[model samples]
Target: MRHDHHGRTHRLELDDQSLRTWDSTVLASDPEDGLVLDRSAFYPGGGGQPPDQGVLLWGGVQTRIVGVRPRDDLWLVPDPDDPLPPVGTQVRGAVDDDRRSLLMRTHSGLHVLRGVMARDFGVPVTGGNMEPGQARLDFDLAEVPAGFKESLTEKLNAEVAADRAIQVRVLPRAQAYALGPIVKTATDLLPPDLEDIRLVDVVGLDLQADGGTHVASTKQIGRIEVAKVENKGRGFRRIRLKLVD
Candidate 1:
């Protein structure tokens, strides 16, 4: 199976992160299992990023997609009150641009934070979570290094101001791992059976095997404010950040 495909659905988002709308055919639709499309741009939630919400239009009607079930077949969860397009129906699918765009920026901003942490602090991320405009990443560090929050905030915005380019690529599993500890986390979450690895690189800064949407450049991430830094005990520190306009 190709990395760009999830079961029977040819995942359009993986190839074109900027794609907001497309046309596709309904391959399966059920009240219980939800709808499956021949081609879909709806990004199923993964890597701390939530799934996309959108709508499918057909014959003067619309079925709002609220969530996604990433099973053997990608199942698009529809609004319970909305109507589902029957199989074989041609539908126009549209992703919520505002939500997805914010997510891309927020996800990219976190990468900049990760890069700064690894470069300056020499710590590994233990866990993290994100929403549209805000995110938090936990790192394995014993000392706070005095004025850590203020210092980190300055470094993060500097990278954003520098406008570093962000690139995405797919490489064979062995070739990806050969780059020397690509995973920045304390725990390795990558699947062992995967043959192809998708990588996101913040050029000249950080690179890791990731399956998430991101902006084209650090400049697009805008201003990153280190909101808070907490001591989670046992040498774990949680850093919360927000994107400022």
Candidate 2:
């Protein structure tokens, strides 16, 4: 869900993530409950990517933020069960760069994997999930052929070597629909009043409507290894993967 507190959405880390620390004011929050900033660099856990963990700083008082979620607004939950500061207070928000970096690599790896699978075998992945350093994707197919893992591993590395620039665009609904995103489910997950669709594009590779943080280029993802594969009956197969970097 999109968060619009005080009629402003969080200026997300869409274009560049070079800025690790964000100096902003609290837009809205409950003193007994949560924190909502005017702008944030934290990823609010969506599209199989997990939320970012960091800290909120103000007046030398540092509050650890273990998780961030979107309700009507991006609620910042403090760790050690601390109470939230009042609204309109100044604070510095920072994301765990190491964690975010791993997520970026893992997230981009999956997209490249999806593109390669679709291109090489013409198979659409049914579902997927991203973890700290690894991810798993499911494909609805009868059985895997011999040497499938080797072939997939080669393709994934080749894409990372391609060094493609990952682009993001907030497109109008009509323009976004023309791109034909491969949605995971029949139920639309986008916000009901969402006028613009965020399109994640791996240039010369893949394009889809997505909401997640990613590395700027495919090269940043380094390499990928197909760690495991689970054969689920009824034509379902799950493949687990890890980022080589």
Candidate 3:
């Protein structure tokens, strides 16, 4: 969502099994400006999921990619004082694997909670975001009584225990719009010129149009600890959760 969809590279997360490292070539580079690659594995920040960081190795040297911005094009910005790979240079990009794994689990945990809320309580998730190991989701329901969150937490862990497989696919815009995903925030924001939609399905559980990276299964999300519940007013409520052990 940060850059024009066309300017972004083929998302590495879509491959499901290809998140470890990426090999690419420098498409554009400026010592005082930033770097652009022919293709990149970094997930440009969007959908409440922060961008990924790692190192780019070239000519026996490593440049830490501190962050990325989508000004005009997807720019792979390196940390100041770090060497920048020049245009036409061959580079190997490595994402912070541990951080990425934790984020994937946290993101998937939020999706699981959303699915259970809809399936059992008929409540829809409104919005939320995630940090490294924790996440939160908002719901349209209000004035929930005693033991409501306790029961919800129980159901959330049940999904993880089930170890259901996670599936990802790119559907045509028309067909994707027809599924009526439980969450529509991301899909609804896609630029009109976007031809295909990315869908993440938690097997027999939940499905939504999501652009963020996620684990391959519910079991990979680990156990979720309900940290707090809040009344956001106007019939909005929030559940904060974290991945544990």
TM-scores for all predictions: 0.99, 0.90, 0.91
Question: What order do you get sorting by lDDT, best first?
Answer: 1, 3, 2
| Two-way lDDT contest, 1 vs 3, winner | 1
Candidate that would win on TM-score: 1
Badly placed stretches (over 4 Å) of model 3 are: 1-8, 31-33, 185-187
| lDDT for each candidate structure | 0.95, 0.79, 0.80
lDDT per residue (tens digit) for residues 54-100 in model 2: 98888768878898767766787778565566778899888999999
With a 3 Å backbone cut-off (N, CA, C), the pairs that clash in candidate 3 are none
Per residue, candidate 3 scores C-alpha lDDT tens digits across 51-167 of: 888899989999998778867667887998888887789999899888888888998898898888778767777788888899888888867879987887888999999999988
- Would you list the clashing residue pairs of candidate 2? none
What are the per-residue Cα lDDT tens digits for candidate 1 across 5-112? 999999999999999999999999999999999999999999899999999999999999999999999999999999989999999999999999999999999999
Model 3, poorest ten-residue lDDT window? 1-10
- Give the TM-score (vs. native) of candidate 3: 0.91
Candidate 1, residue 212: lDDT: 91
Clashes of 2: 0
RMSD of each: 0.7, 2.5, 2.7
Better by lDDT, candidate 3 or 2: 3
